[model samples]
Target: MPKQNFNEKLIARLKTNPDFVDESGELLPAAVKDHAWKLNHDLIKFLLSDPEIKSTFFDEIDGHWVFNHNTFIDYINEKNFLANSYTQFRNKIGLNIDGKFLPERGEVSLVWPYKDCVLEGGQTKEAEKRKEIFFNEILAQDEINQMFDPKVLTNWKRHTTEGEQDVTDIQRDDNGTIRENLIIKGNNLIALHTLKQQFRGQVKLIYIDPPYNTKSAANTFAYNNTFNHSAWLTFMKNRLEVAKSVLAEDGILVVAIDHHELFYLGALLDEIFSMENRMGIISVVNNPAGRQDAKFFPTAHENMLFYAKNIEITELGRLSLTDEKRRDFKYEDIYGKYKLNGFMRRGDNVRKEDRPNLHYPIFYNEITKQTYLERQSDDDIKIFPIDDQGIEKCWRWGRDTFALRKAKYIEVKKIKTRYVIYSKLYEDEYEGEKAKTVWNKPYYSGQTATQGIKTLFGSRVFSYPKSPYVIRDVLEITTKPGDIILDFFAGSATTAAVAHKMNRQWITVEQMNYIETITVERLKKVVGKKVKEEGRLLEDIDYDTGGISKSVNWQGGGDFIYCELMQYNQAYMDKIQVAQSSEELVALWRDIAENSFLNWYVNAEVPEEAVNDFTALGDLEAQKHLLAELLDKNQLYVNLSEIEDADFAVSEEDKVLNSEFYEIR
Candidate 1:
């Protein structure tokens, strides 16, 4: 066959094969195409097992045979094959709409929309904003790598209940796991990449309440929250892709978002993690009374999307019984609290004909109130599971189950002429129950969260702080003590504080200027101190009493290491944003032109004509924006490899800590 015709012939053969259809009767090719043509290696292996398919692609080279991947990929790309197999299959399955333009209807894959571009998301401070960089602008991987190199960490301090101490070295456990809880201040995207060097496949759980992109003051993020829909998606996509690499194999990720981007976020996550790994979406009623400004429906709920790094091996934790749930256990015994459950089946497959084996008779003694699978004496009375209408029903358990736990667990009761068998359902028998999809509780309310933060900070310094109870419950259900939990969007340090109180190692990163004022201070207070009134200690009480402190018994004495990504050109950007007038910006521009690393496209000489043009723009904000853009985004932070360079003023203490953090010699 002609080399070009090889793919056409192979596609024709695959179309006729019945093995291409899955158990659900969906074409496997269609499913694969939905996922950007990234074939499931297992399915590829299985398909190659067929002699007809194997012989067509496998070529014997010397002593071994090699499957021609390019030829197979070409076959999968054949338009006629996909149109006939995928589009027709969707239509047959009732997924098509006459007027709708579904993304899947096109030849392009779902992730292709943003795949060809990269958003710089270079906003390192609250005032800075992102710039889009197309694939064509990105010359090579080397350039991208240079921009994302491991950053140098400075200002390392270990905080304890006693006081803060300079940290020259990182503490690691016997297994070489970093023992210190960490709070790093920088751009979260860059911070995540830095963390991946040491924490790849090490985090147990990651929970982030990221920017909702709601275009409202209530939910605005510090790193420029006014991005357009596609820009917002690209921003999230860049961070989420890195976040996935940092997750442990069995780690769980939970993302909190409002309705503004819920559907789009879901689609993005599906593209990144695949649908098979998706756990479920949880609806949390954070606003019980609802927002008054809502146009139609008063919005009261936000969603949490849960996913696992590998769903098959991910083990979920259970939630403790609520007061309402505890009420169900009405009876108590020496063993513990328990309730009576009907031994007879009440739902589907309850009919005797449905499960004839379970419909067998059981002997019951009225005096003893005990149930037996078989009669022991004449006093024993035979009973059948029958309803009031005289319809026979099957026992919930089969004969084998009844015989196994008949003495201790099964109980027989008599009321009038009818006999009922019950099973002792002990509350202690189960550790706890799985959390439901909807979580509506008083403690989960937004007002409660605001009040809690006010109590901690003496005022509400932050907007919409997440409730500590929410974070506590998240940790309780998803992690064990000592497992690392990460929250890149660590607003107000709620995740870190909760993680510390719950006994999990944590890492939080924030880029906003408020990280020092609010985020770190919250964590420092979490480590324990007496409540102060006007900078004076009110009492000898050594631990915080607000939020979940009493619930988790957090008489906190833990500590965390705080550090910052040493700024390079980012310093100039900060100065530019703070400049008040055109004269000040002009003066700042002079300093920037001499000292800062400018974008490759920006002229280095600070041409007098260009300076005159900059002055002519009279608008201070416009001048500031232009000056900020002139600085190179790639050199925002000092890279780890440049720590020894004297021009950046690398302190000896910072160099030691940076080496220890990155595990470099």
Candidate 2:
């Protein structure tokens, strides 16, 4: 038999018992208290096979020896020996120098929830069926240790337009309210941490459409740039951990991904946001007619993993009724347009035995063509539930309920030989329906997303922009009119445009060079600004009008600030890349020593005064080599800790702006 996985509820119950210990005398503290281990059916069977272990954890219940939670935790902890000491596993994939790995300072190691689960291919058939137990190995490592290290945010500037006038330094509106919307151009990983300084625990919703990392060269939508499995996992792991920090306790996170990385991403999310906090997985059929490149089953849907910081406080908004749904109320009465809905209970456990009180009969008067809960005379015809296919069913209401509400709700119709009963479901009394997990909305298609960008920009500028309507729908469900929405991946700024149209505050970040050309220009058109594309007005271009501006009746007036990560190492790298000769390289090396600050991690012993010694070197090649060794190539931004340092030269004007931007003062 396959192994059964213990749920969080069972784990919680196990922690309450004090006498829980395994056959090997190991305590259950780690597994029960820290969620450090999980018990599967196979492992449970193994324990039961041993008399000493079985006696401790199993109890006879109704002829079966059921596994006890207290004993199970103890048994698993003994089988997998865990220690409090921090230890380094060998660098199998070569991510570190000298084949020795060290955990980043303050990194917490998570215990593997399952033991002896083989994840790699070529396991037994039964083991292959137990994929969830095996998959937790992918998330067994410590959380990305270097995630929260401080970085710099620089090149701050606000961008807005007032009736064809380009404005830059206007920080406040006419009423002096600080602008809430922001468009950041930089590495999203660094930008997320930067935004956390001001917006942590304040943002209500986050919708990120990150790189799918589908390794198909022919796939236009794939990021094209590929990372090995481990690298991809680390990249997503680092970003998601920080993203979770910025979310409010009641906030919702919606991520869009395809099949290629769905399982891995889901596992990573399980580790970051404990499995208990997962809201649901929505399957959106973006391409109803399956893609041609699919090998086995033609792919038609993408997954949207929705999670809440706290499930108790999370509530989703409803979707409005469509015209087709409204048309269901075809019949009219004095009350309103009404529809005939059968007054019979259907589906599982709906028989008389299930709801005995609701199985009563109704009386139909042949003369007046009216139904009643009570019989008036002997001539009155009695009716009972018999479905269209002639199977017996039960009435939806009890006798007392039918008696009190029959006059207003019950309707009678005469078939050839019998009477049919229905309840008048009125259109005026209809509330919106709950949003479903399967989304087949018309506007979620990739074609719609493409046309939306083309219509706004007068050409195809971005690859695979999400439909603004889809974003609007997400916003409508997850946010109120004044809530804040963030999209760090901000491709084509669709989330920002939708948020602006929906009257919600928004923040978006993009790392591409097209931020000025495509993302900013799209928003400009959204705000009714006449954006010029190559010296021509976008409004003059002939294109189909199906985007948010036309649908929302947007006239447009809002402001957003644009900024970039302050360049330190990248500036020097840029100069080095452009140097034409050895003399130019020598000059560039001198410029870097004067302008940039070296990362403290690079070499703490090297003092700032020692920079002069390198610049004094006569050999050009030696100068280049020494400068490369001194600078930390990975630390692109100036550290926040070094903002006040003399080498960074942060002016008084910048210090005030930095403080104001972060809302720290």
Candidate 3:
């Protein structure tokens, strides 16, 4: 059997301990702790002293000497070694980093102590399997499971959409709401991963129109056009894991896709959501580029593949205009027997006994008191039945049914019309109107085009995006009222707007900052004007500004602290070092980086008590304040002391390395 991995025990320890990545666990990065790395080769040497761990697990493989640890035994045994020399290994990781093992607040990913690999595709099968298993271990680790409780996130109060929010000159909403409902600006992958525990199986609906797989080929049928198919798939897969987890039981995930990756995407979705609950596709017109100017069939239609949690069990409801519905629901036959259309049309042989008048060359309508032929048209001429006493005149229904229809018949003479044959009229479950096989809905050009088309439109008035009318028609038959709607690809945030208009509270998530900017602007204009214009989006007599639309109690809003992820790049540090003043620091790193970096999650504080009590990253805003305190205290002397003692040497081999004494006070 192979030796155990360090992570197995580490993960086990973290689950029970919230500060698995903080002081109580692995110490935070010294840069974050306001210090430098200390050299302690003694610990490194001791770690290497484990002859068994070194020789077997750390042997050279794929030209790189990396350890492989997968089994529980490997973990337990290493736990024994680390326990025996816990201080040694811990010090080894922290060695050359001068900071004391200080606690940091907040929850953070604990995938450190991991040496990143730059060379790829050369690992042994054993090594590959080890990495895969280790990755899974990290994802399923105990501390991660303890990060956030599902019930807690579910109970977090939704902000009111009313009142004065935290709008300022720097972060003001365009229409001037204080702030947004949520701001997640970090790597979406990291954000999604962090949210898995708290949101799993709770989101009602998810609509993501991710980038398409088309970098390898030329095709306009795509979403994100920059990455390769595999890259796009990988990016989407990571988020899908969280998105899937976030869904409520009666939820759905609607992905927007064109012709390019339709087949591939369909397969991917099948894998994600099992084939069992996938309903048929709703073909939508996202654009109007038709066959008019094409060499091939127009590919304007998009597939919004609907997936229901439990179709029969879902709470679905709908209300629409009854007048617009087709009226050719029932038709009467000429045989005096009320016959139906699209039924078996059974009358094996024309029986004279079944209907004595069925043998007539023409049937006379007693109501109109006029002779009628095959079928009646809406013409003023009083004419009737065209008959050769052929198959058309055969009694389609039982005589018993014809009598029922005749009893319910109400008619006036003067106009020519067929007499009511009960089977053709009041027949149970008739296949009513003949539906047209082709739907001719066209995709209008995007608003950017329309606004430009008319100079008077300031990208505002009549921002009438592709209406909710389209999605409503598709959903009315499929969804009942109260089902949650979602739109991750919310352009102008109209999907949720439409959902609200149709009595559904929709959750829309937009990843693009510019789009978010535009979303806030459009929402302020539309929702505000809508309230002032159409009252509110509520159902109750007094309940105005429903959850789906803008609300009155809204705070303008609460505030969110922004943060960025730093991957320990030397250049990042260099930029920090070169900064001359606080103004420069704010401008160069703090301010710009906030908008540039993606956030993993937002919380009042990272839950690790000891860490929170120590480090500021645990409380981002607090962290910045602490940095101010650190500067005022002028603990620069301690940093100066650290730089003096480090083993400064230069190796010609790694020439691109820094040769300066960076651990300055």
What is the C-alpha lDDT profile of model 2 across 186-286, one tens digit per residue? 66777788778667787789999876655342122222001224435666787788888888899999998888889989999988988888999988888
Off by over 4 Å in 3: 1-205, 213-226, 246-250, 288-298, 310-389, 392-439, 442-457, 460-467, 529-665
> What's the CA RMSD for each of the models?
15.7, 14.7, 19.6
**Candidate 3, residues 223-248: lDDT per residue as tens digits?**
12112243344445556656777677
User: Which numbered prediction scores highest in lDDT against the true structure?
Assistant: 1
Please list the C-alpha lDDT of all candidates, in the order they appear: 0.73, 0.62, 0.37
Q: In candidate 1, which residue ranges exceed 4 Å CA deviation?
A: 1-145, 221-226, 376-382, 412-419, 530-541, 607-612, 615-618
Local lDDT at 76 for model 1: 55
For residues 1-665, write the lDDT of model 1, one tens digit per residue: 66446545554544454545443333445333322234446546755676766776567789676766656544554444444333332233222334221222222111101111111223233342222211101112232435678999988888877668877678898877788899998877778888897888899999999877553445553212112354467678788898999899999999999997899999999999999999999999999898867888888888889999999999899987766777899988777889898988898989999999999999988787777778978999998989889999998888898889887788777778788888888888858978889988899887898778777776556767787888888888999999999999887899999999889999999876778888988888888765667887654546567888877777868889999989998777667656788889878878887888865645666556566666765545445655665566678799988999999999988887887878887
| Top candidate, metric TM-score | 1
Candidate 1 CA-lDDT value: 0.73
* Candidate order, TM-score descending: 1, 2, 3
lDDT of 2: 0.62
